[model samples]
Each structure stands twice: as structure tokens, then as C-alpha cells.
Target: MTRLLIKNGAFITMDEEQLQFQGWMAIEGSRIAGLGAGAAPEQEISQASEIMDGKGMLFMPGLVNTHGHAAMSLLRGMADDLALQEWLQNHMWPAEAKFTGDDVYWGSSLAAAEMIKSGTTTFVDMYDHMHRVAEVTEQSGLRASLTRGVIGLCSEEEQKTKLAEAIQFARDWHGAAEGRINVMISPHAPYTCPPDYILKFVEAAHDLDLPMHTHMSETLAEVEQNVRDYGYRPVEHLDRLGMFSRPTLLAHAVHLKDEEIALLAERKVAVSHNPVSNLKLASGVARVPELLQAGVTVSLGTDSAASNNNLDLFQEITMAALLHKGVSGDPTVIPAAEALRMGTVYGARSIGHGGVTGQLKAGLKADFIAISLNKPHFVPYTDYISHLAYTARGSDVAHVWVDGRQLLRHGQLLTLDEERILAEAERCYQRLRG
Candidate 1:
């Protein structure tokens, strides 16, 4: 097996102790062999087939984006500054209806390039044409949890067709790409799906034994609509429909109530907090401090480039750290370290990767990134986590690796052609506009 060693780097291992040290890491094939503070033993160095000098870099686990629609990168800025429903109904859905599988492929490729450049190794995507998305994921060499999100507001036959497509997608793609890809079952949302249709998705999830993902309680308007339609809030409605019966990850969740928070914790459902997207759409801030205190796993996500205008997970991390404190009037809430964890460790756990690639540890997948920390923004690095959460930008990322394979080197993508992706994305957008 090929062996590689990265030495003389400042390592931020987001393990249980949050160990930060100047050390070396050994990679044997696809897994981390060992890592520790200080110089490597001569045996490890001598046996290495390749050695990388990490002297000027800060190495940390790659960011995990818990929720996003990768193909929406094509729709970025296409229709912004609108409410979620308006954006979806008046603009997004119409354009998406005209999307071919090729559009999805190129758009998803564009998203993968942005994610790799920004140091995100794993992401969860829910969208249509997911086979194209999975193809992009396989080619880009990134880990992903993908779902074919079904909107069930149409006729009964159309709803059945969409659900069948979703199920076929899950069966065909789950555990694909050398175990780098996993599949999920998703109904678009409570407002879009009837209770009976949502129950069908839950049953499919149980049959396929896959996790579930969906949008829920993103805005007061959405919650109120759910209450008006179903006589219950979004959370309670979904819970009654048995979505929580599976391991579930909810996107947005900006308008959750106290009881909803407690119920999420009790059911062990995870929430992907999209601070930038919510703020952009004028959605109220999530009760994050309360959610964290309630023992619910809160992870960070960018939602979609159309909503967030970017795929940078660092922006989400910084926003998550600052947004809650500002709203709660508590400076201590969502400290820098916890915010960073939300983007990395908690994100992995939320997507059912808790024991996999969230941290830099022995026996785990070697999914990590090296940031050039010599810039002015990172100077006087009194606290690494603080600097990471407050000052670091995605452009600081210099190198990225997943499964011990280098995907980005010196901020350039190795597995993907960025120029072609950009051109195709533009072409697709123009086509959609017509």
C-alpha cells in the first residue's frame, strides 16, 4: 500500500479533546495510520513513500456541509432577494422544470469545485436529477449524502411517479462510489407534501434503511401555512407523519419552538442551520443557543448558492458563531470552537458520519485540509479556533484531501476541470433563462 506522511504542521484535531499541536500525520492507503504532536519517529519517516512539508500550513479536518442543493449553483443570483416561497414558486421551480440531466451534471460539478476550493470534503445534497449529481460526486472524488427530493403537490399519478423515481434513485446510488456516497429519502417539505404522501416517503425510508432529510420550519409563513393546512406546526405535523422514525436531518429549521426543540432532541433529529440563507430571505433567526442547550445536534450549512449566493462553508461557520450571540444577547453563546465544530464534527454526526471523517484521528478516513495561515488575518493567532471562526475565509484553503487522496493542491482542484465547469454553468443558466 502507498504511504504518505505530512510533517511539521500545526494540526487541529477535532477529536474529543480538540487537540491542537505541531505534529505529523501518517496515511496508509485511505485511512490515517497515526498522528501526534511533535516530530515523527524515524521509522514512520523512513517507511514513507512520499513526504509533504506542511511548515506554513494549519491542518484541520475538512468541513462537512450538512444541507444543500448542489444543482442550484446554476440558479445562483438568478432570482434573489425574494421570500422562500416566492423564490421557489415564481422563479426556481419554473427554471428547474426546464433543467435537463446535463444541466444538473454541470451545475453539480460547479458546486463540487467551489466546495473543494473551500475545503469541504463532505456534503449532503437534495435535488432532482440526482443521478447526475452522484456522477459529479464520483468524478470529483468528494463524499456525499444525496437524495432525490420529491415535491408531492401535483396530481396523484405525478406524485406516485416522483416517489418511484426517488426510490429508484436511492436503491441505485446508495453505497456507490466506493462507499463515498450514501442516499437518503426526502419529501420536499410539509407545505409541499400532503400528510399521506409524506408518510409514503417515511415508509420508503424504512424499507430502504436510509436516512431522511427535508426542509422544515424555515419561515413563520411556512409554519403558519402548515398550521392552517394540517392544524399542527411543521415539526409536530412531520412527527405525527412519522418522519422522525428514521434518522433525519432537517434544513433551515429557523422557526422551531421550545417544544419542537425538545422533541427534536428526544427523537435525536439533527438540524442544519443556514444562517446566511435565512438572513438573506428575512427568515427569523433560529433559537440555536436554546437548541444546543436542549441537546439537539446543530450543524452548519450554506443551503444553496441561489439562497446563500456562495458555497463557502467558512461563511456559514462565522455566521453561526456570531448570529446566535447577537440575537440572544449572550456573548458566550456559540463560542468560536463550538461554531467550528458545528461546521465539522457536528455536521458529520448529523449526516451519519460520526465515526468517519469529521476529525483528524488514527483509523479514520483521511479527509482534511491545509490552510495557509501566514496571512495577516491569521496573525498573532492567540486562539486558533477564534481566528478560524472569525477571520478565516475559504480562500485561505491551500490543500484538500479526502480518503487520503489529494483533491485540491495549492487551491487548485486536481480531479475537476474548473474552467469547463464554469463555462457549462454559464451556458446552462442562459438556456434556463430562455
Candidate 2:
């Protein structure tokens, strides 16, 4: 087991309560074994096999992307400035049909490079060709929860085949790669999935004890369509089908009624709020304040680089804070500290890794990043929490570590071949254009 020590840093542990600043963190094997403000433990200190200086760095738990189509990095800017339906049907889905396993591998590798450079250590991904995505994630040394996005609008036999594929992927990959990869069953959405199919997926999830990930109420059109077709809103329909009885992570959730919010809280469904994607698509802001007040666990996500234009959780954190405040007309809606939590600890919890990661406490996984604070934007920083949430950018990430393995050091990625990945992605893009 590799033992490493990161010493003399301004630690910003986004723990359950708030940030713990100016501390040292130690990693033994793949877990965090020590973290505190004073001197390192003498016994463990002497036994460390390696030590790295963390001066002029703000160390915090790595950002968790609660929801994303990571391989969609290949389609970024190809379908921008469009509504959700137009973007998906005309651009994203069409291009996705041209994707081969190699395309997925290269595209996902590119996404992983961007993520590691931007300090995202773990991500929850839903897309097609997930085996390729899994391969990329494993090789990149990033932790991930992967799912094959299934559209249940197809024939029953097709649905069964897709479901079986997803189950097999889960069985083969979950807890694999030194416990770095987890898998989930993902039904595309309510509009795409019939009630019977949704019920079937839920049953499968229950049988396998796997958590469910899906899109829900991302736009008013989706909700209105659900009501017109089923005489119930999206959440109401899913709840009636017992979809929320299991551990479920819902993406978007931008248009929900008060009753739907209550139901989400009642069932303890986790929500992944994609503020940047929602804003870019003209989707209305989610009722995050209401959801939080109702006791629902809400986390931040970038959705995909195609719609969000980037995979920076710092931007999502700031947007989540300000969007809710402006939408609700309350200044205290989501404070900076709370916004940071939504991106870190709350995000880990939403993806079902809260107990194992998300904090700098002892016995947790050593998944964290070091932000360079020598920049002009972070000057005269009195409160590290506020500065991090309000001023930090992805470019400010100096180093990133996942499971005690340094994936990025001094803004250079150690796990990916960037030029080769970019060239392969460009070739795929040209093929799509043809």
C-alpha cells in the first residue's frame, strides 16, 4: 500500500458542518488516515513513504459531479444556443448514433482529462456505450458511478435487452477497479419511459439493490407533457409507480409543483441541480429552497459539457447560490458555505458515496484537490470558504488526487494522453459532420 503525506496546507474540508481550514491531511493506502491543524501524528509521520508540500494551496474534497453525460464532451459547442428538445433530437442523439466504442473511449477519456484538470475526482455518468466509458474511467484513475441511459419507448424485447445489458454492466463493474467504479440503473426519463417500464426498472433496481438515476421535470414542457399523457405531473407519476421507494438520484428537476417537492422530501430522493444547463436551455430555475426546506438532499451538477460548456463545479456552486437567491427573492436562500456543501459533501451523498468519501476526516477516501490561491482573484482572502465558492475557477486547480493517487499535478494530467484523445475526438466530429 502506498503511504503519502500532504503537509503544511490551508485545508478546506467541506465536511458535514462546514469548512475546516489550515490543516494537514495524510493518506495511507487509499484512505485518509490523518487530518488536523497542529503537527502531524509522530508515529504515522515517521512511517510515511512520501511527502508533498502543500503550501499556497487550498485543499478540499474533490468536486463530485452528481449528474453528467461525460462522453458528450465530444459534442460540446456543436449544438449550443438551442432548446432542450431541439438540442437532443437534432444534434445530440443524431451524433450519438454515429458513436462507436472507440469514439466513446476517446471522448470519455477527453472528458476525464478535463475533469481531473478541473479537480473533479468523481462523477455520476449516464450515457450509451457505458462499457467504453467504464474503460476510460478505470484507466484515468477517477472514481465514477456509470449507467447506460435506457429509453423504454422501444419494443418490450428491446427494452429487455437494454435492461439486461445494464444489469450485466453493473454486475461486472460495480466495486471494480479497486472500488473506484460503481454502477446504477438509469431510465432515461418519464416522457421516454412508460409507467410499466418504469415499474419494471424499479423492480430490477430493488432486486439488484442498485440505486436509480434519471432525468425528471427538467422543463415545463416535460411536466406538461406528462400531465397531458398521464393526468399527473412527472414526479407524481413516478411516485405513483413507486419509483421513489428506492434510492434514486434525479437530475435537473427544474419544474416541480409543491406537492411533488413534498413527495420528494417524503421519499428522501436525492436531486442533482444543473443550474448552468438549465439556464442555457431556458429551463426555469428549480425550487431548491423549497426542496431544501422540505428536507430533500440537493446537490450540484454540470449536466454535460455540450449544454453546460464546461465541467466546473465551482461555477455550478456559485450559480446554485445566486440563482436560488434571485429566483426566490431572498438573500439568505443558499449561503456560500451551503453552496460549497452542495458541491462536495452533499454531492457525494447523492451519489451514494457519502460514507466513504466527500470529507477530509480520518478513514475517508483520499479524494481531494489543491487550489492555487496565489492568483489575483483570491487575494486578501480572510474567509477561505467564501472565497472558494465565490471566486474560484477550474483553471485555479493546481493538483488533484483520487484514492491517494495523484491524477493531476501542477495543472498537468498524469492519467490521460491529451493530444491523442483530442485528435481522436476531432476525427469523430469530422465523421459526424460527414
TM-score of each: 0.99, 0.97
How well is each residue in 1-434 modelled by candidate 2, as lDDT tens digits? Answer: 77888888898887655356665778997889888886667775787889887888899999999999988888889988899999988888888888888778878888899889888999999988899999999999999999998998789899999989888888889998999999998899999998888888889889889999999999899989999999999888988888888899999898887888888988989999999999999988998988888999999999889999999888999998888888778999899988988998898999888888888888999999999999988999788888888889899999999998899989988888888888988888788778
Residue 372 C-alpha lDDT in model 2:
94
Candidate 2, residue 37: how far the Cα is off, in Å: 0.7
The top-ranked prediction according to TM-score is 1
For candidate 1, give the lDDT: 0.93
lDDT of each: 0.93, 0.89
Best by lDDT: 1
* Tens-place lDDT digits, model 1, residues 336-427: 98998999999999999998989999999999999999999999978788888999999999999998899999888999999989999999
